[model samples]
Target: MSSAPVETVLVAGATGGTGRAVMRLAQSRVDTLRVLTRSSDAAADLRAAGADEVIVADLLNPEGLSAAVEGVDAVLSAVGTAPTAIPSGPPFVDGAGNRALVAAAADAGVDAFVMESAVGVGPEPSSPLATAFDAFIGPLQEAKAAAEAAIRDAPLRHTILRPGVLTNGSRTDLVTVADPGAKLWGVISRADVARLMLAAPTTPAAHNRTFEVVSKPRFPARNVSIDWTLP
Candidate 1:
């Protein structure tokens, strides 16, 4: 399938780590960087951080998302819940919120969807490290797995990136991307993930693909090379 360049992109969870990195980095790359946030107060700062427009909406409630995704070429979701929030209850953002977003994006005619998922959230024989990580996070990984399934079933073209441990380290641009079942285990910076998410929509190789991403110089799995430049 052919993928077209994104002139306007809507970023969900623009206040989170990877989302912030995307907001900071996407300023010069895209014609318009739109952000969706739950807080109306975040609008000014998001604008200052290079967001051309800010739509205040919560993903858990799907009603307002049609407006949130309207007129955007692509949707990039970095939404996730912290481990501490696991005990609180259902309606976990990782699964429910993202599923809602996927539906809304498809409804609004968004061309592509990019999701930041965690490793071990898809398929069988998950690596030991990923298994342990999932166990530590309780139901979060399961929620992400469901979200991944929702994306796959949706009509829109999608790219799901399952990153190992995420850190606040710098963007090295040396990332190792592989199929989900690869023996991939390591950490990657939020900045690097942001770079790839922004690039995925326009990169034909990344369309309708799911990848496991990790920082380079670690892990023995064969890496998948993708042209990360925005067209």
Candidate 2:
């Protein structure tokens, strides 16, 4: 199948770390880059950072998101709240907010939807590290799982990237994408994750796939091929 060009990408949660990175990287690649942010205060900064346009809209409002999704070829969602935060808790932001985004994307007939999730979200964690992380963020993990389910059941082509513990470190460019049941665990920079989000739409192996990602030290030989059919 021929991959579609990512001309205009609407990034939800464009004020966050991963979202910022996505905007920075996307500026050079795509013709138009738009962002959905809750604050108008962020518009100037986002535009300075290469966003062609910024829409001030809350993800929690489905009606607002409908307008935000217009004319975008794809939607990249990096929205999530801190585990300790209340009101803007996981149930609302991660679960309901993401669900709204997915529904709007489907309605708008977007070519693709790429979402950022966590490593320990499914029925069980594939690695010991993920299990420990899950124990730390129980409710948050459940919310992410619910959000993943919503995307999986949506009509648009989707790519769900579940990254291990996120860090502030620089990008390693040495990423490993693991299947659902694979025991993959490690720390990855938010910038690297943003790279994957930007690349997902054009990657044939990434469409309608969920994978775990982690950055590793440079190996003797690199294996960049993604096993799309891996179980």
Candidate 3:
């Protein structure tokens, strides 16, 4: 028999592009889908899109977020800047908002977390190709780096996907990223990224895994399975 499904999930930043995809995917598979949106109208859209519960809360408001996350099995975050958007504000959203959410999740007793970061951020990114990120993508890279630090170091069990260049495309469910061979870089579909993020907690290999993901394998119809052995 199949294991019991994760009944309820509270998705933060559900109105955004990748978040919307994750929400829809979760709703289709999980028993209940709950979303947190700043705008009532956007919450309505999420509900119309089949969200079972829409909680209106600002990411900046910890109490409000704590209230929203209550009684959920897990939390999935796809929060990020828009394609045409680069935030130039103080009290950075990616860093501060993620920290707040971590606390809120703890308070709400939601342990499993699936979050997104980028492919390169560490002091020495291990891969030579990642060197290019230092100058061009500092803002987002730094913010995501800080948020990832919070997630990795937090008390909760987390799986953070540091995806390569994201594009809206077909989700082949064939993406790969790990140590040694995978430390290099490439691109992945946003849809596939969402699918992997939503599927993280369900896979035992995914627990406490902070890996990068890229394009599909060259071989098709073989049923790709990524080995999570640390290099």
Best by TM-score: 1
Models ranked on lDDT: 1, 2, 3
What overall lDDT, based on C-alpha atoms, would model 2 receive against the true structure? 0.82
Q: Which ten residues in a row have the lowest lDDT in candidate 3?
A: 222-231
Could you tell me the TM-score of candidate 1?
Answer: 0.96
Which has the greatest lDDT? Answer: 1
What TM-score would every model get versus the actual structure? 0.96, 0.91, 0.85
RMSD (CA, Å), each prediction = 1.3, 3.6, 4.5
Q: List residue ranges in candidate 2 displaced over 4 A.
A: 86-90, 217-224, 227-231
Which digits, one per residue and each the tens of the lDDT, describe model 2 over residues 1-231?
Answer: 557777889999888889988888888888889999989988998888888988888877667887788888889999988867744454467888899899989998888999999888898547887798688877777888998999999998899998888887786667887777666777889988988998888888788988888885322232246633211
Rank by TM-score, highest first: 1, 2, 3
Number of the candidate with higher lDDT, 1 or 3: 1
- Measured by C-alpha RMSD in angstroms, how accurate is candidate 3? 4.5
Which ranges of candidate 1 are over 4 A from the true structure?
A: none
